[model samples]
Target: MATSVSVAGFHKPLYSTTFHGGWGTSICGDNSTVLIKSVPEAVRVVKPVRFLPVMKNINEGKGLFAPVVVLARNIIGKKRFNQLRGKAIALHSQVITEFCKSIGADAKQRQGLIRLAKKNGERLGFLA
Candidate 1:
């Protein structure tokens, strides 16, 4: 007698079992081994924001060119760049939130940071 068993579309099996009986039942082919691996928590990887380049330029005494560069960026409509900038902004908010939590910021102080982030986000075109 010939028997074949396979699990399709499964990359890894969490558990496997083999039964040996008095009737000569045995694993015919490569034995399936169950591997227990510790899956690390999903990490939020914030990519570098494209706006950093422009910000760096402005910080390096080229502030006068900001408006022109921003206008050009707006006209170009770089969706991916904008998305990255949005992610950067969200990461910034997360950092702020963590800082507040660590320092035990009061309700009033937390609210102040929230308002400041929102206002700066708007001014920097990070928020709609």
Candidate 2:
């Protein structure tokens, strides 16, 4: 079961009269308020879970099999991390084993690739 749940939405704020005739004067602007339900209330809404290979790659490297790293890398502001978006899936354990078998990367080289991918995510603020 998921641990955290929340529902948030934006609503316009109410305004009181101090109305001025000029277009320059009004009580309301672009202001909005966010409403969030309590955790239990939010949990009542069942959300679908998605499983993606990219998420698996990031999660496994970080030790949890969680997939948020893919999304974070896309927004991490580094060209290298951005380049890793869809490309990181090639680093998955299954994929890596296949590639290493094909190219004969030694155990040391295999470990290096794992570290490199994990380090890349951590440096981009995605792993944490």
Per-residue accuracy of model 1 over 1-128 as CA lDDT, tens digit each:
23444445323333346443312122322332211112233543358646544332223223444465466557767686577667887788788888899999977897799789866655554343
Model 1, residue 27: distance off in Å is 78
Where is the poorest 10-residue window by lDDT in model 2?
27-36
Provide the TM-score for each candidate, comma-separated.
0.36, 0.29
**What is the C-alpha lDDT profile of model 2 across 48-83, one tens digit per residue?**
887675543343445332346545655685577756
* CA RMSD per model (angstroms): 17.0, 16.8
Off by over 4 Å in 1: 1-76, 106-108, 121-128
Model 1: colliding residue pairs: none
**Candidate 2: TM-score?**
0.29
RMSD of 1: 17.0
Which candidate's lDDT is highest?
A: 1
Clashes of each: 0, 3
